[model samples]
Target: MKYIFFVLCWWLAGTLSAQQLKGRVLEAGKDGNVGLPGANVYWLGIPGGVATDVDGNFAIEKRPNGRLIISFVGYASDTLEIGEKDHYIEVVLKAGHQLDEAKVFKRGQTTIMNTKSPVIEQVITGEELCKAACCNLGESFTTNASVDVSYADAVTGAKQIQLLGLNGKYVQMMTENMPNFRGVSVLYGLNYVPGPWMSAISVSKGVGSVTNGYEAIAGQISVDYKKPQGSEKFYVNLYGSDEEMFEFNMNGSIHLNDKWSTALLVHGDWMEKEHSMHHNGFLDMPKKAQYNLMNRWAYKTDAWFVQFGGKFLDENRLGGQKGFREEMRHQIGEGNLYGISINTRRYEGFLKVGYLMPQYENTSMALLVNYTDHDQESYYGGYEYDARQRSLFMNYIYQSIFGNNPNQKFSAGASFNYDNYDEIFGDYKRTENGLVKNTPVNPQREERVGGVFFQYTGTFWTKLTLMAGLRYDYHNLAGGFVTPRFHIAYMPDEMTTLKFSGGKGRRYAAVLAENAYLLASGRSVNVAGQLLSGRPGALKNLDMEEAWNFGVLLNRKFLLFDRLLNINLDYYRTDFSHQVVADNETRPGMINFYNLDGDSYSNCYQVEIRYELIPRFDIMGAYRYNDARITYSAPEGLRRVRTPLQSRYKGLINLSYYTNMKKWQFDFTTQFNGPGRLPGGNQQFESFQLMNAQVTKFFRKWSIYAGCENIGDFTQKHPIIAADAPWSVDFDASRIWGPIHGRKFYVGLRFGFDRD
Candidate 1:
């Protein structure tokens, strides 16, 4: 039978797997610990081999039964003979740490490992991404706790991220640290970035450089695409979900002779199912399609670095009553009717150049320019919303030292930004007795913004660092604003660091994007005044949402049971001067929007730890707590609302087992989320708990992973919102919390290659 043939093939592949001739790679040091990462470890004259990671851990397969070569840059090469009995051995490299993960730094732009910033920074390297199969870079957060991903309104099939307990818009998204997220891209941009092409993702929480322009209320997430000069090959991936969605990811890198290299990354998604099968008379999902493309090139030499890249994205979605058809674009329910369609296109490009100064050991000057064009068109039950956005961004980062000490580094930078926005919320009417009538209400808006910033950092006392930054914004709509940030770090010992940050930040909030679910019911926005000036039929009254944030954090590392253990904790708080609140209790057909009349704020606390228990075994855990609220003018003059619903306590555990006895490995991981508050529409949804787990197996040249989400199938027993007037204007989709979907299982496989 075919099943037996398949089993035979699998067994043959596993049986042929190269026998283990393991070895330990170590750094020649005083304590006999610390592995040399990036060491060129391989079998002598073998056809293939690999280097060690920073932890000096590596597994090389397909090597013949013989001797091997150990070589690294700036270090003497050594040869070691191996016999069949020599399953494992230990190698100690000479103290020339150059071969031991020595980072490269030449000027303005550098990797986090080489950065001299006083703030804490972490990098998610490409190699780590390859450890699993994922569709987009946004999905890469599976193992990272600093960033949280959430479902974008259930029907839209979109996902947004959270950082420091704040929304994605507040965290600031960038391509290589250059501004890009805005307009339509703000809706589904997470899907636009394919996972295969990213080289690394850098996360800088707390206050960053003023040069980045102060958009980050909690942190900054910079996406770094793979550079063209040094890239590995062509990749193609196919991913599918139980919900009947398919995703395609591909990236190709080519060398045009010696001086030129180019790369193109693309992501495509499609779904055939229109109904969610729950058949609540509401579309469980929508017919949707999306495409994204990015082309990048980089050139580098000993003295100069130049990189240029461009990106484009297009997407469409249609949703409504279960039986609704796109051709009719209309429907009527026993109680009411609704239909929705959305289309968007976005384009962006950037260029950066860096010139290293030969006079200074670590000095460089850089110039950068970023430009974007974004637009969107959509219809929510025949009420159309059209929008366009254009922006230009520029920044410079220069670094040098006042003294001969290379560690005594100083950094400074400036930035410029511009934005032009135009939006129109189409007219609307109502049908009370199954009769249609037109009520003319056209709302439009236009606005512009300009900003400038300066930032610097320095180190003193060999154990202290300070970073202070400032920024000013000149608006064509809301007048002016200022942002100031400061950070301090004190290291009592090499293993522990106490870091604190204080910053004042302000953002002109775009309410709809921050909470699009509120309008999922086709509720028109009712404004008191103008949001932006100089437009016909524009909302005459609106104001910017402003706030200030401060944070303190500490991290410690130790050697437990002869292995590494890491712990990190942070606390952050924000105070709002002006916040936009949606008052739905007043009118069901529309919502009230106004600046805060009282107090509004949020608090966040988090902790994480990771430890290696023994060879091939490790464990990790994370927890987060968020407290947020908003105050606004009500019929009662002022009222406060707790943040919609969210989990207050979250935890995760992971374990892995591998050994030299067999050519196999197993990995298991579990995540747990605790209950929190929920909102009430006609009625409130109850808080709930969630637990999920996955298991993976590695064999020969292939890897396999399978998992079940919502393992307990926990969900609110009651509908999220009550008073579902299918015939009236009283409907709300924003009152959602906890997992709405039940338990589901998934599986995946992966194989890769690289050529030299």
Candidate 2:
């Protein structure tokens, strides 16, 4: 049998190489030793534990009569005693509380949750993205409550996100772990990052971790930039807004000695003012300019690690009506107004490598590479969309530990993906009773995939945890597939926890580069079969979407009166089997794309809470619900409804405060939103409330801030559906829902210089 399966894989790699235990977990800052990325390293009666990466490193597996615990979350916990040749270590912790004679620090927790992860992660940080005016990553989830950002039409302002309730292209995004934005950059790619270049973001709800592939299904965000060796040798931010919008950012870092390092980042933003608020002559937002750049490099040693990076971007947009202009977009008849244009260019490069073997014991190996190029050109009034994309990705991993149980672990991988697309869509003019015709459609394609994966994880007695994974892929055009995943977590004490997960995901549906916001609406675009053919691997008759996600989570903590309270609950479900339906409601102008006939689904539910209510004051709350359905094709035929502009429940509340030598800070937020349907599903839309606030002041390195957004200005009075015809067919700017810009205000300034 293949030489007894190669001698049982060489006797399980010689019984997993025997013993191990490596470390790192620092914190003693003032710019000197930071690295505590998700702390928590255990061993006091071991049962598998680890969590540290992003420079805080870790590796575990040697236990023979314990004593090691190290913790985090506001710090102060540590212990060790391991000798017998202690295989590498470094611990450090220490910050805050020590009463009876001084020492009081406290200030951490701007969103974090990771009671030993088995997925169901959270982590937002960088102090919750500075409260507001995050200026990118599409406004960084204002006070986040499990993702949900909007604005997908009402004149080319494109922004979208939603998780568990779907969309955001089934959520996979990623940056530090590679695969980003994907195909034509998913409509503006969430404004192309740049929220001070993030220092954390990590979401992760369900179904993630087949070594990051198979497109997350409805979860997984991961960003975490800001580190070329822990950032800040200089930094700056300046912003302004009141609808005139403006921004600038800068970053810096450089080390070059203890094993190299480098970083550079820059960004610019502009908005050229023009707001039609509810007067609706369109243009409620758009008229933007952007430029971004990045550079990164790193190299570490003591068992090698290297990173490399490159990025560049350019963007411009201009929206319609309000006296359209962008050089009249190829005028041909009488004042050619009604304009909207978008132009974008992007390029990226990446590489990562890691190694650790040194003759093995807790072996390791890693490699990742990425490349992307995206281009877009758009017009929305006479309808024209253009796209281009080229992508490449690769992955390779190998980690070990099994027979000599480091609580059993394994990872094996191989992956490759490549995509090439060029698209163009129609109607340059086309008026019927008035003659003017030109129609186009050019689609091109290329896709390749190759995969292999295997994952396994286990832990037991010290409070469960188990995971399993599998993968197999081959797709020159939808020909092979197999993926499976599972997870489980349990804690049941130490203040509760529980989790469950399930997965399966698949992708390949760039349908006009993800709907290009339905071509800003005077619709007319349909495809029911031959799935866009300009030849070249014509997608073998479409169908490569597939889904399956399942989830459950629960976390708890409570200690009230003396502070400390946290609660969470989660539920998720997604089911599809195949999907690629766009269908703008049976027919209304038009927009159809097909490949699924029966049911589709989504179900989400959430509940959250956090409290600190006394010391530095904090509070949070959340609620969500969605039922999302699908099955369309109706003039009375296949029906199943709901899922049209989404919404059906959401709520939030937030508050924050600080004062006490930390120097003033305050924040507030509110939301309610609920009611939805809109899209020929018999009307339903109304229910609102939104508010925001912020303030800050600090010094030493500098800080100043201010903010406000939608403060009850609620707006949605007419989100474009035909406001006095613009080449009318009932001009439909994609039926948005709520907030078409209203209460504004913003201000900012920050400066830094931390690295020392």
Candidate 3:
């Protein structure tokens, strides 16, 4: 009966309908009435609405009340009641004196939109970022159900994310629409971005448009930093946790004039001590320090806008046995007390320039250029690896409409990518005869690609939207390939949307470097199958992975008891034509790398709901199921296997509450992590639950927050295998499935001065 009732509610939500009206706003003048820009237009009681473009035009859906409101600075506000016969109307605003502002309250800080977008995209605002101790990008997704973040390895404390049961590397990472964080930086790049510096985050799932690239097999994540012109004058965040972590971040803006502005962001963090809470003889977490700095400048005019920025990062990490000291780090091959050390430095710069066409307000041309230099040196026990990466990227895009119809538009772009990697690495294993030797397999390669793409988008009466895109790319090693993508969105009513997407993606694999953590164990690396020859200098001898992704989603929003409710259901499937499988199931102490000989696929299904139960209280819940598998070649022919450490089922619940005046805020989140088959012995781990809570008190210019993570204190009894024999061949740390450490508490403070 409960399930039937839930289905009935969903059916009713889709049946609600509304009328959409389009219009323009102009300023009253003595000479003539001119279009007014930057006007706020919306329904009387709705939370979301469109803002006027440069031409001062708006389109909005209206309820039965048929009331519309328009307001702007230095202009008198106007309210219009539309009759059944009237559909489109134009209004002129007159200059008038304004009174004092009125106090306002909001139910939610995070908003998800599905009005016209063919692909599922959600924007996480800075206000939502404050729900937790979000010191870095990896920690920022604690409250989001779409993405799952977890520790990559038990020893290094490195974090990785998953989308639709796929690894984070399959998701393209971008900054302000420019490609960033690729190649050698994929393992640790998620920690380089400080949360306080971000203005918003855009997460898009499924096959995206070819305008971005051909690498997005799972999704795309784009980070937008606070703009120099519209950001606060000064901001500071200080954070500390009971786990011996401390962090500080500060940013300030400087305006050269009305047309030019710049902002400087600085960050520093450190974990001062090593804690072995589990008594496993290994440190629970790595002790590390990181320093980051960035400077961004923006120039805006009526005809053009340009932004340029540069960033620098330096980080060091150390971990291993509890007794290992820094002085013994040099004794890599002869150490009884194992230790891990890593040092990294990265420098990046980017420029974005856009020009608006004189006659058309919605047409523009944009060019983006980015460069990065990254270097790393690390040692795990007896293994030593060093690498450097140099990359340059350039892209050009042109956006325009078909004739004068805004609903029909297209974007064409060309891009160039270059990456050079130089690496020196060796793995060592202890023998029964009391000897340790380095293993063979080291690669230094370079890759270059050039591509062009065109995308066409069409919208019909705010009811349907379609996007088609195609791109052709030429790789130095993989030869040439073409990728095609398509997306369609249909709205049956004002509250419901149905979307579908399909596309192909390809990527060059860096097997050894990407799986470097496995080298820390006793596992011996082996390569099988026919290797591509004559390309040792360039994109190594591995088969490039190609896959096709298909997705379907349904989303709806409705009003219940004068509060808003949102529900979403989605399913995604990925089939690989060619893939590199890192097999660790055949043997206990062996890791094999080879191209797939059979089939590889993943299917994911998810359902999510968000409801505003009271005036300032919101509840969000989600459930997900994943089936990911691959075929491996074994001594006994071929067999299908479950991908190690991939969860099959998961559930989440998040609650948020705030006071009437927004002075006090509280949030709680609980997650259920289902079991997964482990590598080596194919062990099936038990399911577990995790809980988190936070409280915040806000002042005029400052706010303080305190939070606790893993509040239930649930932890894996033995995350590491053979903890007592770290030097033995039976030791393996790559089979971790759950948290290594227990409950942790943190507190932080944020202070800022608004430019207004």
Candidate 4:
């Protein structure tokens, strides 16, 4: 009782003495004052900070001895002392253009750390995207060791990403702070955004902010598109591969006066020829074509900011036996020749509005609205599936400093979501009486959710930060529920930082849509489980999945040989109170779906080390381990088992070198993939090693590069099951555990010019 009373008194005293400071950052150009968007601003010796908005405005809590620090790229950093009476100030930075010849530093390959973020966040800049063949968002993680990407199946050529040994679906994906790639998009949306359209990608592991809703179970990925006002006036990229794949992208920006600007982005890719490497009667990769376009507009002033955008995408793919053609797809039921075809179209529109109070520097409000429509039709062997979805999302958030001091910050928000889905599965078949019938495996749903959330952040002694958040949501199907989350960061010294987080997350399982990749095989689909009350249809009684995530992280940086070295270590665990299990091991020719009856969890640990080996040369190494298990109902009743195809361990090493003035560049990466268990047996796959290398030369306004992927020429012997019998019950294409294609060579060129 005494300890509790003392803690309360201390908190009360600290809350009564805090204050907030607001400011604007600009570049002192010779001709005029230029706002520096995305500038970093923070209080000296503090663990939390904020970035300047598009209009170059910022607000942060202040301390008794508060000192302000502001920094921007290509400019000299500035630090200023704050006075008690100073509530708002304007800072100007001078441009610095000094190049170090001996030690060339590249911004894109560097993993920037956000010291102010309560959760460990890593920022990957657009420059990093140039390091690989980054065709789309799914392929952008090739250089990032934290996220693992693999082929979902050999025939359809679908790629999937995993974080902390969990599927990417558990990771909330966002575009400019608004939700994206949920529901139907979860299937193939990873390929929607072209790499050239992105300015940066932010990755945060563990429980993320509750302001984005409770769908995040593993982590969060936020993508930032190139801004219309700051980027180059025009840019173009052209790429081609030895395997007949070609791509083109163009980006252009226009300024409609000082307060209004617009940007247009376009991308297209096509593989005109299909080729087979192993000659197993199946195409090595599917022939695909896609066209994507986006238009974004921005309007900003001293008090109000607005942004709106729209995107459209169309894609088609075909794959199967080497001789199979699109014309043969209609005869799939006859089974003379196997083929697969898919078509998809998507459209999206979003608007964001922000208001900054002129009288109060610490008060602001923001509203976000988004809408999406997606449709897809696909055929795999004798099976056919079609799905369509329409969704709308809106959120309004208000933020301000409360209490006696600025150290007490609060955020309140309300959100609404509506989704409608229509889907059909199965195929036309002939009955025993020789009558043709259209068999339907239907699963349809309509969901409406409204939620309100509040978050509080507190700082103590400038070295410790705490955040507590709660959200109340009403789902038409799941009913009412509350989610609570907490986070803490402590710095024992200037060199070491420790963080901990725990949170609850819930999401509805779109079982069929998410698992459609499984349809490429001959396995029969089964959906038998306890259903929710008062619900009817093919998907009746399916309960929502919920889980709790907890994690701990440690980061330290030291000086060695007059250079800086950084080490990062983290561990995360996930426990599922309820889960929708996709079971493919209990039966030989069937895929079963049911609710979890027992325990299901995952534990992961990772470590990373980075150091500068020499001037203009850097090396980085990382290792990770994952242990994931689940309980399933078998013929002998419920039993715990290891999740199939989950790697037990992984290792990575990267080396990079740059010549004087960064005119020449070289990069190499090697990775080790550990063994994993296969389905329906205790067998495990053999470990494999992969290597990649690239070289590039830069000119004044143009750059050209060449690279080779899978340099070791290593591939799985047989990626398909029962390859000779495509229509047999044993035929399955979803058991891929390694790369199916060997070495691949590609080249690309980029041209961009800066604007005055």
Candidate 5:
């Protein structure tokens, strides 16, 4: 079977190679030629186009006798005729008409859909990020309809995301195309990246390419940070909220020479005040303090490029009853108050190098290396948990045209992943016959994997595109496996596009770390059979989880009332072959882990529309439906039931308007959440609505914005069961369905200096 699949992939790749046209666009500067980023390049009558990269580099399918057009803001548009012999070209653009006392106005879309790539992708720009109080990555998805962000539990204040009706772990997370936020960091890693340091975010639906890894079962999300060589010289942001939360951020860039540049980013935030707005004895939010820092350096030459960076973070959190403090973590008893405390310190570093081959046209090779060390200590009520992780990753790739055919391109790569973990978890205090006891479980593990992959891309007639990839990996623990992915895109006209994608993905489950929030409850932890009978200190020998995903998308654009209107529709389905299930409903007062023995699947559908109501006024609306189920062991054998705490449907509407001079902006958003079944599928939650709004005023060199969240002040009732008794078996904080806190207001200021 493997040999037949390999032969089929190779045969499909040999049919589509032609020729490609490559070039660079630059602006005529006083000192020298400056590369212009974000320039639009397309054929004169083509259906799709592409934008230049950060270095003003672009590649397109070569068509004989076709006219190519390039244009950018504040620059004159240029058109040129292409010939069969031309493979590379360079063009310089001059400034557009200038008036004596008039200003040139330019506006760009806050969100964009890529029409050229084979994969379905959406880009969120920095302008859209400012619509709300985006203090961290967890809060940046307020305007997006596809990704849903929610709190994991009521006490820890930890946030998690859902994509295609699946958990965040199934969705691969990346920073600048590198894998991150794995293992122990999955719970709180969303809070590490400061919002002020982001430039853009890209979200791709369905399974991604195999070059990254075999872990993207649902989708992929990649974040792009502000570059060191950007036009910004210095920037700062200050924020304060109604809950007495204060934050400060600053970043600056410096150029050492013509070939070297560096940037420094710093962030600090604290919330020392404790509040129990519900008067339920338990605090609504955690008291927290965090400090983060990063430094990056970049070097570029004609044929070589190098970039290196390092980051450090330190954070502390305290939460529980209203009067509980961090100092009372060890004094939990009949007379003492219940408390929760967590402390974390992390370090990360990475290096990337790329080289362009002068001997071959459109050929390049690159290498990437990354290392991370994370340590955490925490205690929930009478339970204690401590963990440490060390991970290293490396990838190398070679890219070039196939047999001098510009229309056919291929890339081959190899990757290595290593991980070491140490964990200790148990209850420090146990009550038995009016006496207290102690029980602890310690488990350690190390993993190593090496993989190689090949990917081929082919384009025909500038309307149809096909991409296929295959990868094989050998794991020390799981033996060997193969992953295959395929994608197809077709454009029927200038305003219509259709895409289909399918792929297979696999990964090992990190049970204890991923479900750390369950510790806040009084439930006991257990394993299904004799997996931990003899080797009590060794980790469970569970099967690696595997799944297949398939999806289809349709995008159309047309004129309505003489204005452009866009509509998008998509559907995806995921089927699991092997899964490690976390069964909390089968047995009351106990959390059990076991291997799956039946069916598990998820189906998702979404529709989105964007239009302009009036000049400078834009509106967007979206709706999504989900059907997810899992099989679990019950008192009467096995049964399939709906997943707990997952909403059946969601609706969103967003409105934005700005003044003519762009000095003032107003934004409003509304969301409707449908009810879902609670644990055991015995009861259903009630539907609710939420509203948010913001207003911003811009000055010459700074801006001020204010916003309010949960304008309706709608919150879930009794989010925590048996809140009055923390040591009782009925106490559970993991069954969260909606907001735990009430309305909140915040104000912020941003100042920046532009480079000449």
Candidate 6:
């Protein structure tokens, strides 16, 4: 037929050079049915714009001038100026569903990309920790072998984080994903989250598929800060270390004209530090000052969208008798010992809203809200502690799939949470020969908790992806618990892949900041006493410490010469038949928390490797293992014991090199710790502990670093006083583990600015 009449004359000569505009994507003062999916339609410099199809109808063959633009993602992005003729447009997208920040696709390193997410994700940039000159956020990546930081005992200088070797309180640390630290902010909140306001820090190890909750069993740390449209126009930093700490960090962002934008952050730290009183005669670490302030705001309008932020923190901690003076604990014993003090306060606010509907084509719906206030007061050795808190959170959302194969997709959600708690626990009483009493042994507590959740996300066969979730919680004292989650990822071709993750979680064990050295060695506290209110307790009828953890994972990526190679391994098993596990080796001042006998479990493992080797230069390595135990019940059966500052093997090495004329930089890191199981029964120390390192660098706006930490200053020699029960009553300082202070040489500096 004459070649189909010359292919319809070249498709009508490209539709007469295109020109036609028409729309409906509704949801603004509704009246009848409506829909709004993905919302976004363009013409702000011409070039075809369309992103709304799941029914909210839209058709435009490029022709509708006077700068037209529309946007989405928590709404607010719209523009339309003086149209000469044809026109019809409507947009309103807003719904900040509690949390979701999974979108970073730049793909490079033996490329074979196409994602639908089932979890096996990795992205650690800020130019890859810029060689970890990271002076904040607890030693910035310390050569990150999937994150590890531990040093909790040996007297409060606090530090905790261990993923895959488990028990960093089972991961789940968020900021933009906002559950922002958990419980009592996990002791020190990693030095008040300041690593120059991070621009990226997302690491997931296992069990996090049920809409991001039940509770990640052993992994999840998401932090992304540098907004106002991807900031970086100014920043500054400064630091000093050599046991006499010092720090200062700052940032700024601005743009308040076309649809408004703003950001600001300030940081401070001062250390009149002097570590090493080695506890024996008291005093290990305590002389500090820290502060933080943050602010953010954003706005947009095509339909509507809004954002807001606020934060403030102040802290001071003092260890004990380096020269004692806490008003001298009971004059007669004037040598007066042990000291610790703290004061903390916090406030926060967040919001999100969206509505757009009119049938399907690109349909939409959204809502999210948050609020918080927390306060604290603490002291030790004359005993005094106080705490106050308030919290609230909400979320709701719905997204589309649009017809048969734009790759079928769907999301459903609902959530609500609330909390209130006030507390106090004080102690001091002695007689029978020693004589020191002022009539004190107190406990006054109050609590309220609420929760609800449901979530589902699905996508089939672009290479498989499935996420299922469910959560229901009620705790007045650990009454009800139900959490179920499932995650899956399968792509067996682009090179190779197959992954599966599992989940279930819950926690509460703050009987005095997780055993503050068993009430600083005044002992005598026993729970399972039915969550305690006072009784004949040594663990008298308890419940409210339930746990059931299940996990599995395997990741693999490859490329030999063309660069890019990665391999990851994971295995987790945590099963607890109600637990709190903390004992003091049978009578000796006493200390216990029950619910187990002959066996309780936690077995963790990890292996990692990464190589960029070419572009700028990068190298990575990791190895971790943990097998914690504590199983006892009956007239003295199964007394397992061990699990504190964990270290049964851990190794790491990291290196970085950067360029793009973005200033000079180079970093080197190292870490190694092996040999676990140490708690009272030392025949003169030396059960393994070694940490080594080095650093060199250059940065713009602010940066300077000098290092040598424990340059093999390994410790744990003569772990304090226990020269065979010196002061009788079997002297005990909570069986410390490793690093009682040794090896020191340091230097530091940093500056920050971003959020523009």
User: Which numbered prediction scores highest in TM-score against the true structure?
Assistant: 3
Over 4 Å off in model 1, which ranges?
Answer: 1-117, 127-133, 275-277, 330-337, 359-361, 403-410, 431-448, 529-536, 583-589, 656-669, 680-687, 695-704, 716-727
lDDT (tens digit, per residue) of candidate 2 on 7-83: 34643433332365777889884335767765667666533354564457665666745687876644577779887
Error of 3 at 494 (Å): 1.8
TM-score of each: 0.80, 0.34, 0.90, 0.88, 0.89, 0.29
Model 3: per-residue lDDT, tens digit, 383-409?
Answer: 677889899999999999999899999
Candidate 6 per-residue lDDT over residues 539-602, each given as its tens digit = 2324445556655454544544544455566666776666666666554556666756656677
The number of the candidate with the highest lDDT is 5
lDDT of 4 at 168: 80
lDDT of 5 by residue, 111-216 (tens): 7777667888887878789988899888999999999989999899888889999988888888888888888888898898899989888888889988888899
Candidate 1 local lDDT, 1-756, one digit each (tens)? 784465345434333333445555776633235665556555654433544543565445434566777765434456787765665677877644332233221110111221224565666766445434456766677666667776656556567787766667777788887877754467677777778768788887765767777677767788888776555466666666676777777777887765667888878888878654343556656788888898988776667778898988888888766656566544444444566677888898999998999877788889889998888776665455666777788888787776786645555666667766666654334545552423433444445556666555667776788877777877777888888888888765444566778787656665554444555654556666432122346454457766787886666555454344567777788887766666655455666677777887778887778665654454667777777776656555566766555566566665544443323445454556655545433244444555555555645334566666667777543322432453345555444455445676666655443334
Clashes in model 4: which pairs?
18-405, 18-406, 19-406, 531-541, 532-541
| Residue pairs with backbone overlap in model 5 | 18-406, 18-407, 19-406, 19-407, 20-406
lDDT of each: 0.63, 0.79, 0.81, 0.80, 0.83, 0.58
Candidate 1 residue pairs in backbone clash? 335-726, 335-727, 336-726, 529-540, 529-541, 530-539, 530-540, 530-541, 530-542
Q: Candidate 2: global Cα-lDDT?
A: 0.79
- Model 4 residue 511 CA deviation (Å) reads 0.9
- lDDT of predicted model 6: 0.58
